[model samples]
Target: MTEILLPSDPEVRDRCARSMASKAFLTVWEGAVRSGKTVWALCAFALYATRSPDGDFLLSARTTATAETNCITGDYGLLSLFPGAEYRTVGNVRMVRFRTRQGEKRIHVVGASDIRSYMVIRGATFGGWLADEVNMHDRRFVSEALNRTAMSHDRRHMWTLNPDDPGHWIYSEYIDRYEAMDAGERAELGGFAHFWFRPSDNPAMTPAMLASLSRQYPEGTPFHTRYVLGMRCVAEGRVYPFFGPSCVAEPPEGVRAEFASIDFGSVHPTAMGWYGRSPDGAWWKVAEWGPTAEESARMTVADYMDVFERETERLGGIRRDRLTIDYGGGGEALVREAERRRWYPVNPDKSVLDGIQATAMVLSSGALRVSPSCRRTIDELSSYHWREGRGETVPDKVRDDFADETRYAVSTFIEPRIRRRRRWSRT
Candidate 1:
């Protein structure tokens, strides 16, 4: 048997021990990111599979790639626990084959990203199931997965996830229900065990790492509240609370205007921004333009194109490849017109939460700044608030035209470069 070194954190060790000993039908480890929950859950799953009932096991994530990366091949994942384990793909199914006390057992890997994911596990019975980032999976897939494991003798399931909004379906349906149940009620339904972990619980995290994370997600912010404190809370108030006088500045000298991003609209204002990069690699929003509601209603695609060409010329002409535009709403007409002129505009990445987080990180790190002349952009920054009661953290859509363009420019262009630089530095 291979020796497994456990974290020194007593709480983590105790939870891992309890997970193996518990007679729970469902076990959940939920909390902060990199909080050792996945490691603990994987360890418990390894133990469960050794003696679990007479059926194939299931291992899943929001996507197949994620399932493979986080659960099977990650540094602290299942394959690490079972050294020399064989992983293979047969037809549509990806699985890991490993020796157990009973015999060789297989764990099928699947992704439950959408409603259609339920079809992947429809008729198959599973002895046990282990899910990573269960909150990202569709509710229908989660329901179908649970049903798939109903016939096993153990019928146990383990789940791990970072904290999401309090009103999320996973919380309202499973976590809340479990917490609300009386001790007798829980016992009567086999059992449901839950564990909470904070970053401090992860023995692998260095003090410096914790400090860096604290800086990345500042205090009183939604990211800080959920990720650092490991709390499920609603996101309210200003979305970019960090944007203030420090973030607004005159365009720095020797800045090269690199690209432009457009948030096209017909009913709402059509917004655009010219972004530049300084010698120090910092990003600056040098200029912005948008038609008023009245002007937007009267402006045709030709008018918008003329404005785009004039603005591009004023900025010394940006490469067509660097231009990004929102493809939704009335933007498709603008995109087609631009293409006819041989200006291929790339579609912006419209992932709201991720874009917001990346934008926040850059702004907070002083890597992003906006010219004081961009009044509308600055105004949107101050007024952009989270949409309440949506059961998810989302920026309110009203008056968000400039905000959307800024997100497109930063997230689509700058954030990936920053991530690459970070990765390179680590390597």
Candidate 2:
């Protein structure tokens, strides 16, 4: 590791000034992975930390170790960037105390992870705040940090993170303010300005880094969009970050059992998917069929059942015990129909967020594969998202039945133990 020299790039220099001078309560740096965002963010915080600083300041991340490793300990670390700073530990917490021409300054290191995360820094009134990988933090903790920072006359914040889903709160809460400010509709900076960084912006990044990224994420993947182009796009926010051609394959011959997953919708398409699980604990979507919203309106319950039976038989032999259908939407008719066929009513793990995470876990590990013949399922997997204020992982309510059914399959089979985990796995 080498000392980080602040960039002399004119655009970077200009943006740094704009960010520091802005009146916004929060300034955000978002872009490609391994962009110089962390260094840029530290620069902004350093300025706030020492320039006539008042009250305590905060430097936080998703965890305390990350904040220390990323900013405080490395060669270009915060202590190195500002050599005169004094470091000490108070009780369980670590702090950096420094001097400004106007006064003394302190930056307390904290970690923000969940709803109760604000407790770590609850009593401190910070003049400034900075958090790395801000997207991984709970929104409540972020809000609390901002609220606490109001104590300072020179209130500033530097929140940094890799580009994430378009629906992510950072875009709505911080990035959007920059947009409104740019459009000349706002008189003030609104305590929000965002600087985007691409990997190429960092002089240290070599051609080898680009090649490794291409090999890991490839073009046309969500990872490429967020990490390579550094664009905050719709695809970046997908629930399944790794569903694509690479995961499409024929069902393996080691198939132990076959099951059908279905989502019922009278106004929406009723999606039925066949999945084959390998004895080694892998799964593949062997086939999928669903009716369009228009066709569903004309079809009677009996007609729908007939279609389901025919599709089931077409995919070979799927036993009644192996069929699962979502209990939401217009599922009553489907449930009744399934009962007539002597099949069990499918009641899956109803926690929508857990289900989405479970699906992502499977897809990311390459444990779940989709057959090319299951085109609709493949398309839905690529597009399902977490939108509407971060809690809900919903689709646009159209062309999503297959995705919903897959969620059932995922919640039921992929992480049948989600009840124990209770939240998305950070690992």
Candidate 3:
């Protein structure tokens, strides 16, 4: 068998070379877009296939669309690397077969959008597995793919991705885990080897390409981070992109109006925010109760009502006429409980998107103030994000619980007050 030399892109070639040489259970090649991470991972597998007889490998992406578009294992460029090899796509293009000097190599491509599809191949085995854009795939896919090869102690699982948000599972788990190992603070995951590079290392990137990228994407945007500097970006499903450490602000003294917005939950969390009206006619968030999970069994309607009452009192004062909450489900019963306790429990506005827009408007106008005490709310506001890849700034529904509730509360009460204040000033 002849050794196939990779392309002239040293960064891509080096990443491929590194993966080929690694002995760890997990070989990770992470970098920014256009840094040649994908090409390198595929090339390394191709080289391995030619050297190892009947080598069985797996190629996986977040979606079939991605698997087709990226064209890693089944594509021509990857196949072209191996000279005089017969390549064929089988089983609806899920698997790729190659007949070569080293023997027969099978590459299977799997698309996982949800956890159920990942469960199908639970007990399967493989020689190697390549997870592309790992940040985009479901976390369960990672667990399943890695475990499937558990029986093969020598099997290598490779992951390639760009930097993602701090909240992302990959960053928090894989990247952070590797960093801890390097710092001698943690034990390394057996057979795990991770490497990272960026677009700045790519000698193939020309000045014209940089200029074109600049023209195509806005400065400080995800495209700039992922493709230009090769930085990790926040996941697509985050809601509070604006919630971060930099946006912290002090709450004002002597509130004129105070209300609490409660979001009831059991598995997700039962969240609440205490708000106050400041002297400057701005709405200030004083505190929050959020992202909390039930430690034991499902929280009963009685338990939620109890928590709501406690949070309301902690906020200073909750007038029976001002307290609001998300509508539907057990909201009415909770409202009844609030009424019994002499705390207002009106239904908040229901539109998630409208509430998001309403809160954004308040923040943009500098009318929204967040107290240092409202750590969770503040964090949610800063870190909540959207899928920029689809060309929009809308918040992701999955992680926008607090933001949605804020919007609903603001739309129900604060928006009207702000509108009235604006109208009064004009008059």
- In terms of lDDT, which candidate is strongest? 1
* Displacement of the residue 269 alpha carbon in candidate 1, Å: 2.4
Clashes of 1: 0
Better of 1 and 3 by TM-score: 1
lDDT of 3: 0.65
Q: Please report how far candidate 1 places residue 357 from its true position, in Å.
A: 1.2
Q: Give the alpha carbon lDDT tens digit for every residue of 218-254 in model 2.
A: 4554556767788765543566656777888887765
Q: Where is model 1 poorest over a 10-residue stretch in terms of lDDT?
A: 1-10
**Model 2: ten consecutive residues of lowest lDDT:** 182-191
Q: Which has the better lDDT: candidate 1, or candidate 3?
A: 1
What local lDDT does model 1 show for residue 215?
84
Question: Whose TM-score is greatest here?
Answer: 1
Ranking by lDDT: 1, 2, 3
Q: How displaced is residue 262 in candidate 3, in Å?
A: 30
lDDT of each: 0.86, 0.73, 0.65
